[model samples]
Target: MKMKTRGNFQLQRVIGYFHGTIILFSIIIGAGIFLAPKGVLKYSSLNVGVSLSIWAACAVVSMVAALSHAELGTTFPRSGAQYYFLKRSLGPLISFSYIWVNLFASPAGTAARSLLLAGYIIHPFYPGCSVPEMPKKCLALAIVWCLGILNARGVKEVTWFQTLSTVVKMAVLCFISLTGIVLLVRGRKENLARFEKAFDAEVPDASQIAEAFLQGLYAYSGWGVLVRIAGELKNPGENIPKCVITALTLVALIYLLVNISYLAVLTPKEIMSSDAVAVTWMDKVIPSMQWAISIGVSSSIFSSLNCTVFSSSRVLYVASQEGQLPLILSTLNVHSCPVVAVLQMTILASFIIIPSDLILLVNYVGFIDWLQLGLMMTGLLKLRFQEPDLPRPYKNLWQLILVLLAGRLLRDTFLHYATVSLYVDPLKKILSNICIRNACVSRQFI
Candidate 1:
């Protein structure tokens, strides 16, 4: 009874307007926001104003990139985000790299997130001692399969969890932000008063600022979530721009306020030293609610992990749909889920999750992610020029901002890895992303 395309089962447009917004919001508002401020502040020499400015700047850049992708999404409205754009705009060779890279990038990124979630959830049980890697990784793998099974079960189920998690994360963050704002109003400005001299200190060097920028961008990592699920939207052309504007505006506002909220109670030193910023903030203000927020953070990450699996499997599914991979991978079940694609992702994530180092995974995926963004921006330019009359319901010059952001990312990638030994980490991550089997990817792609 379902529609067929090119002998393949077709996907339905079950994702209505609000559900699409939740998908984007939940994915974008992942653990990065709760954890990234430390890296941003430390890298920026603990400059409060500079760190806050970086958060704002990152939001603007993410907005620009999101708007540009919204245009592209309106045009293509397909499964693959960067890959489809590359194949259409640039050519096959470059676009092919996207699939291979995502095969590794998606799982690696997912593993890191899962590990972070597990660490948070399990660490509290140990009280003062550290959690062993085995428990953390076992828990992380369990989460991957659990969420992957949900994904395998149905899109509707995945979206339900996604929506629930989004609401919880939003409510939790809003509560924290309001609590901090209220405290500041009552003249309890221990760390809040530091804002008056926020910009008083000397500026961090370009490299530091660049590092902080990378951290900020990580917080805004899921800005391109809409394009990955563009086809599922009720009316992509209208909904994508709407989702981008609505979801991203809320994410950016929440991120800034939450960072301020953290600062309101905890000092810059405590925040930088903290393994959990929100928990630390809660400890000072309302000690009893700390446990609840811990669970909330885990819930947020769990949903985020599911969303990552949901979006990433689509790329794998699209790969199969296009015949780049076996046809079975694209096959859907009774629930219209790409069960094969979801399972393969879970298997791969399980294997590599053993070596899950959050920072390493972040750096690895960050470079490749931004690199793809660069190519997507390049492709956007080509599409604009070659098909001037393309039916684009939404249009913007945000492509240029994407291009600049990509350039800045590349600059920092090189600057941060000046030494050969240090540089090899990025190289390893790239290799890890593109190389899975005995076959090795070409070096030129880097």
Candidate 2:
């Protein structure tokens, strides 16, 4: 195998601490917050308290994973992110698989979320109308291209947009949370009182609760995007851990309050039945806020799509730089951006948007996403022992806790799907498809 030569590409380190924090925040607080509360409520059997607890638990798990990344990121501080970490600790084979799966899975995830954004944008205009696949795909295409071009221009430009979008998204979520509190203070007894019966009913099976936890984790999925582009940041060793920790804490708090706000306006049953939780809350509070909320949600998803493009392209560039991918993808244009990698990601995402249901898209990527996460975290642990002298700005204090959490997550995932032959059958199909895709990409390098 060819070894990476540092002389091939020069990366600019222009991103500062505050901008780095905003990038992480923008990616974590995407459309999931607007749409995922219902699944948490449904899976937790309509219990407001339990649902909130699950959200908190998932946040803790996410935090542990972020802590692990902080240590690995600060020590290595490279663009390949997980791939770099895995390569150093495990071997090239594992690193190769990480890039191969990510090549398709990352962009497919972006397409899925963009499709979700399109649905919300169109829903308010055509309330009950069924949007055909083509229009949604077209809208998804537009978003991918717009963001792809924006990212190709420069890293500083992307950081400014991310900062502004993060501010707007946080303000909207905080407004909703504060509005819920105000309604409760004004003697909105019904919404607040539901907490009284949070545990009054029979609980769901363990399998169902596990599934709900998985959904909550999906909402917290983008916590690690910052480290992927660590090479572009100023003072990366200090900034990386700072950004990861601050962003994870802020996102978890925002998510918790948002879910609380939803429950405050709509009953658990109402929340479960509603299609869009945030919009529904706004409609209940002030019907005129519908358009405003839709804009906020769309803006939220747009920022996430932009960040996804930015980080994924960087990963591609890093892979190519390391000689794991074709060198053509490592080429940069005059703007100091990976032009070819950006184009490659945009094309893959467009293909993903063309034919897939939102729910299936979400589930299809969940197992692989978590599995990769587990392997990466495991690699981090091994490196701690393997490289005792390696400098680390942040220590992964919760390594043991993360291991137990991942164990439970994987164990429950298997148990839940084992009983359902339907879910089990699809696992094989998805793996086969991933292998086929991986093979096709590998042949290009050969």
Query: Worst lDDT window (10 residues) for model 1?
Result: 437-446
Across 222-271, the per-residue lDDT of candidate 1 in tens digits comes to 76777887777788889888988898899999999898888778777988
Off by over 4 Å in 2: 1-9, 128-133, 415-431, 434-446
Clashing pairs in 2: none
Give the 10-residue window scoring lowest on summed lDDT in candidate 2: 1-10
**In the order shown, what is each candidate's alpha-carbon RMSD?**
3.1, 3.4
State model 2's lDDT: 0.79
